[model samples]
Structure formats: structure tokens, C-alpha cells
Target: MWSFSTYKDKRYWILLITAIIILVLFAVFTPDYILEKTNFVPFSMLIFIVLFWSTYHLWKYFGDKKKRNNTDDSCDL
Candidate 1:
């Protein structure tokens, strides 16, 4: 039952697109000497993990804040 519509937030899409662009740019623009010295697989994996972790935490934090605001507004009535 998984579908693209499951993620309706524009912010989520923006983050995904930005991360992809960053990874692509990093691979293309980095100097050959630097790449030759390091294992690109591990480095790219680390970067991807960091990006996903930060994005998840940020989304959770903002989602909680939004829920709290809704509750507060309801209480005002």
C-alpha cells in the first residue's frame, strides 16, 4: 500500500531533491586526486546517513510543534 502520495509534504520532496543534487555535485566536482585517495562508497554512505538522520529529526521536531500548536488553538476556543 505504499505510494508517492504518502509523503504529501513539499518540504520532504525538497529535502530529497536537494540531497540528490548535492550527492551528484559532490561526485562530479571533487578532484580526481582526492577521490583516488578515499573509498567513495563509504564516504557517500556516511553523507547519505547524515542527511537522512538530520532530515528525520527536523521533520519530527516540526511535526510535533505543529501538533502542539493545534492543541493550543483548540484549547483557546
Candidate 2:
């Protein structure tokens, strides 16, 4: 149901992609000793927070656009 066409702005996508890349780099480059010491809880949580925040903003943008379209249609009648 979701499509990139629905959201014209690419900032959210960029944020999500950047977050994923950072996560991958962290996983690949972080020393084993550091990983073991923290169990990756904090880093993973930060990534999740970024992902959720971007997704929420995207969803809100879509909802607002849809609402504006509906209002415009009603006014045209």
C-alpha cells in the first residue's frame, strides 16, 4: 500500500537509508570486545529510534496530504 510516489520529499528516505548504513557500519567495524561489553543495546536502540521517528514523520506527511486533498474536493462541490 505504501509507495514512494505518495511522499514527494526524499528527506525521510535519506534519513532512513543513512541510519541503516550507519548501523551496518557499526556492526561491521565495532570491535568485538566493545560489542561484548555493551551487548549493543544502546546502539540498537538509537537506530530503532531514528527509524521509528522517520517512519512516523512519513506517515504524518501522507495523512496530512490526504486530508488536504479531501478538504479541497469538498470545497469544490
Cα-based TM-score, every candidate: 0.64, 0.47
Q: Could you say which candidate leads in lDDT?
A: 1
Model 1 TM-score, 2 decimals = 0.64
Off-target runs (Cα >4 Å) in candidate 1 are: 1-6
Model 2: residues with Cα > 4 Å off, grouped in runs: 1-39
lDDT of 2 by residue, 1-77 (tens): 67876366565677668777977897899788877866576877777797767776877788789989999899873
Clash number by candidate, in order: 0, 0
The candidate that wins on TM-score is: 1
Give a tens-digit lDDT track for model 1, residues 1-77: 65675388676677878888988998899898877876876887788978776886688688979999999999884
Q: Which ten residues in a row have the lowest lDDT in candidate 2?
A: 5-14
